[model samples]
Target: MAEDAHGGAEDANVRGTPPGGRGSHISRDHAAGPGARGADDPKRMEGGVLVSIGALLLGMLLAALDQTIVSTALPTIVSDLGGLDHLSWVVTAYLLASTAATPLWGKLGDQYGRKKLFQVAVVIFLIGSALCGMAQDMPQLIAFRAVQGLGGGGLIVLSMAIVGDLVPPRERGRYQGLFGAVFGATSVLGPLLGGLFTEHLSWRWVFYINLPVGIVALAVIAGVLHIPVRSTRHTIDYLGTFLIAAVATCLVLVASLGGNTWAWGSPRIIGLAVLGAVLTVAFVAVERRAAEPVLPLKLFGIRTFTLAAVISFVVGFAMFGAMTYLPTFLQVVQGVSPTMSGVHMLPMVAGLLVSSTVSGQIVSRTGRWKVFPIAGTAVTALGLLLLHRLGVDSSTGEMSAYFLVFGLGLGLVMQVLVLIVQNAVSYEDLGVATSGATFFRSIGASFGVAVFGSVFAGRLSDRLTDVLRGQELPPGLGADALKSDPKIISELPAALRPPVVEAYATSITDVFLYAAPVALVGFVLAWFLREDRLRGSVTAPDATQTLASNPVERSSYDEVCRALSVLGTREGRRQIYEKITARAGYDLLPAASWLLLRIRRHGWAEPTALSEHSGVPLRVVIEAARQVEERGLALREGHDLVLTEKGCGVAEELAGAREESLAELLGDWWGPDRPTDLVRLVAELNSELCGSDAEQPYEESVPRPAGRVRPGR
Candidate 1:
């Protein structure tokens, strides 16, 4: 790792939680998006959580299933069209259209509605599948495949981003398990189904199979995914779209042709690569200037987004690119049938599913995703090195064991990165940020696959050339066929077999050896990922849940959810403190108390900052400070937010109970745009609850009970 990166992680907030306490619970339901409850009523909030889970499952399926489904069918499709050499295109075309379009799709989902756009994607995917089934040849099939990519691209990102939108990262882990399950099941199952269709039916059934499942998924999503609709319109970034697509296509083309179809020094390859670089630079410039930029350039300035994006790109390059070729090696080199290859590939899928699900749940409960990724990336690097050492003679057990290790590493890190990235942004930016990560991953994965395929093919050809030069090769035995299949090389003239098989093994191993440096990139990024508490207390529509009734739960939930917000994280807590104080009149203690309580409940800070922050009179601040110290909650250490272990627990519980008291005191303060006076009044009520004097202007509320020092006392 770079020295700079080490410093960055230290400065960054990626340290996981501070020993104890979880993420503040906030209502992640963004109004006017997919699966939102239009009302902030309690019944609706409860209903929304239940109904939305089912819908999210359906959406996740769209993303995960699409990625794994086409692999088994690729070889068969190539066979039928007599274009085995161009087989990588099947996956490339899908990734190309999907990745390039990801940002646009996410933006539209936020603008229109997640449900509406998601529904549209499902329809589009089904249509593309239908067209693919009817294709007469390769070109037609490729065109239709691009359509499928469009829908598939949005599937994973939208679902994940929405989870970040609605659920706090800490609590979000449990549900994220569902996404892991879908990905794992699909990865294992897709190949088996694809193989069956290729072997028993036709290669076309792989595409056709999506129709029935697609309909069921669409129905589930349309009915259950409910978000509020903003009555506003947004201008689409057509120019941004054109630029991104152009750059993506050129880069993909260059990677695809680099060593296979054309030499690196060839004009076609050089020109395409240059064009891609220029277009990419132009796209960045356009994004920086666009009014409603398809990619939000500002998001990159944030620490979490930057690290998450880099990690996603590396994962795309290492995992996606490398996995794309696993089946080929099994079938062509080892003489394993397609069906057998699917069975052999199950260990990786199994490992990923188990690890991701557990990691997600642990993250939700502890809000410590930073730790898992660290462990995961380290393991993944080790697994890649092991896999690289495998030769043609390596047994199935050895390869499968290596696959398991790699899968386990991948499972731990993949979805958790998405979880953290999604949590760092506000609901409004959730879709855009998520789509950005997904878009980059798609690009990286596509480029990786193309590059590896070209490199492997070229190395094999070169190796074969050297071997053939000294051999009395049969007049009809061509190097092209032998280079592609180790089994074919094994069947060649006995004297030539050893050198030929060795060449194939070397070519394959070189891909991993080259990719090791690339895989380490994610490891470095992992160190800088933020360790903010995922909010378990973020509630949007739960205002209607009785504040007086569940005061403890309400307070705690509110604290966890809003602490990050109250702390001036996006904007700065000091500013918000001043704003609330100014609006509340000169009763600084009361005003400060309200702000501090809000911040504490959000679990983003030590609650004691409230007393010091009151800036009321020293006497008034001291009294409250004494009360907190007596409770053994928070204490002052100069100006820093200092706390004992006991204090952290107190702060965590305080946030949990605060909501009920708040609901009872400020029953009328829930609206998108309420009077500023009401905001001031809520602050006053909050001050009273914490026994501070920063009351609202012209208020005569009952005072806090005296001599009530709650323990850890």
Candidate 2:
């Protein structure tokens, strides 16, 4: 018995390793305690879970902190290097590489284990940090930063994905509060840290700082992260990965370089643009055929997942882009120092902190995550418009209100996307699904920052040229170079200072004017994001582990089937009464069984055949079918008979333990995935919702079980 227990433990240990990695390199075997006990019992999932999660909290903070910290430091880096024109590339490069690689990390994690992949990401981050610190020129710095970004993408998402692996989604809110708090707190801290380094230490040390922090994070992951690993057949989808990477890179490049390094109408821009379109189409082709596609083409067929991804993309595009330029506005246009800008932004950060914490607690308690996004996206659009109207004469009070709106919107929608994606997918696909969501958002943020940076630059130039309409100065210095750096503007011969500042102000205002409508697109996308009913279950602590389908509960299945079969008989033809009686015993038998059989039959059989088989007249079956559905026994699928969730479960149980019975049913369906579809009961859902009306066009055009059909419905 002890050996068997040891073997089980051994098996679990092996499962923690992902598919093809340096095996067991970073498996943190500290389970949250098996049963409630002394302080040492780890698997109990009560107290020790908190301590480990606290460490996880710190680890997540490390990743979120890096994104914002670098933003405030960009201008300072340019000042030190005498390469003011290269500032946008620094931010663009980081986003471009990170955005493209985000899906890959998630895919690899799916092949291996989340624990190992996260550790690998930390190590890669550490290496990139060293390279960034050593960079001597603008181009080298941008290149190294891109490398750092590759590692950074996986760190943020894998941390969240790990939560789903260990805990249920409902209970995850308290922990999600930790994630929100970390993001909120870090936004404030990152800029402060960046300012401190730029002011006292060299700006290069900003890159160096990540080294020690990443090592500490690596140690925490080595000690406390615990998860189960199950060995399974694995296939990496190379064609899909290549195609996706190509399109993502091209799209980001277009955003980053268009209207800046290359004209919007330039041949280079047009070529990359066409290349991106072709790559995206090719990506769809690869996804369709790959057995383990990074993106399941079928997932797009799922309304909830696709809408959530779209909303996430649009939100990232508008929000991140707008926020990235906000600090630049404070420093360049308003003449606020970096430290002061970070402090001035406190109201926005505070609003995010408060709203997200409160929302997390409520969502944790109620297990409802859909409504927040529907409303939050609307709020976000309002904030974007408010920010759009900002200018040199805009009051601090007005600015604060705008920032508050932006913060509130972010607090509401940002984390909810994670919840929606988690709810919509099965457990086996958790890492990929979570990664897909984060990937789109990352792509959005990249485009947002890149495109907005160009807008800010262009507006600044136009304003500068307009303000200097009559002024003539140095021989070769054009308006573009003069307006490039605020520090240079401050030092520009004292006479040029006021006009330069005015030009900066005009450009900043123009950028805001342009940013307003971009945010509205996200608002419109969010409107279409469907509200999915949360499947209430025993397990739910966080977004990741909230929606795992329970194993087949055989006894419940048997009771439901027997009761339903008897109730269907003429001797006991009262399904409503049987359902009511079964409810008292917690059997839920008759209704569940009846629904299961109908779904299996799928109204594919003619009404006469169904009537003959079940021993009921066709007319009575049609009339009473509505009542049968009310009891949750069966569903009337258009003009045919179908089963609901309750019905499907009962039928599976009643199908019996005999191979002949299995063959009789299985042999008729040539579709390889039919068994999997049945197990998930994904098809048993309403065709209007889960299945497409277009997919069964042949069924519609030829005939239904009862009569001829048409294309539309």
Per-model TM-score on C-alpha atoms: 0.63, 0.65
TM-score of 2: 0.65
What does each candidate score in C-alpha RMSD?
15.0, 16.4
Q: Point out where model 1 deviates above 4 Å.
A: 1-63, 109-119, 154-180, 215-231, 363-371, 419-431, 464-477, 481-504, 524-713
Evaluate model 1: give its lDDT.
0.59
Residues 1-713, candidate 1, lDDT per residue (tens digit)?
Answer: 01111122121222223322222322324211345634444345545665676676666665556676677666556556644445566777887877666656656766777667777877888898899899878778878888888777666546654554554322343455455456556677887877777778887888888888778878866766665654336677878888988987888788777767887899999999889889889999998888877777888888998887777667677777667777766665565777787788888777776786677657755667788878888878877888788877889899899989988887777667656765676544654665566556666777777777777777777887888876666654667656433444546877777766677677777888788777787898799787876644222111111000000011112322232222212222233333343342322333333433433433323334333333344444455455556555555545423445765554434432432334332222334664454344333323222212223111124343344433323
Measured by TM-score, the strongest candidate is: 2
- List ranges where model 2 is wrong by over 4 Å: 1-58, 82-86, 107-116, 157-181, 219-232, 356-375, 393-395, 416-434, 474-480, 493-495, 529-532, 537-713
For model 2, what is the alpha-carbon lDDT of residue 190? 81
For candidate 1, what is the TM-score? 0.63
Lowest lDDT 10-residue stretch of candidate 1: 544-553
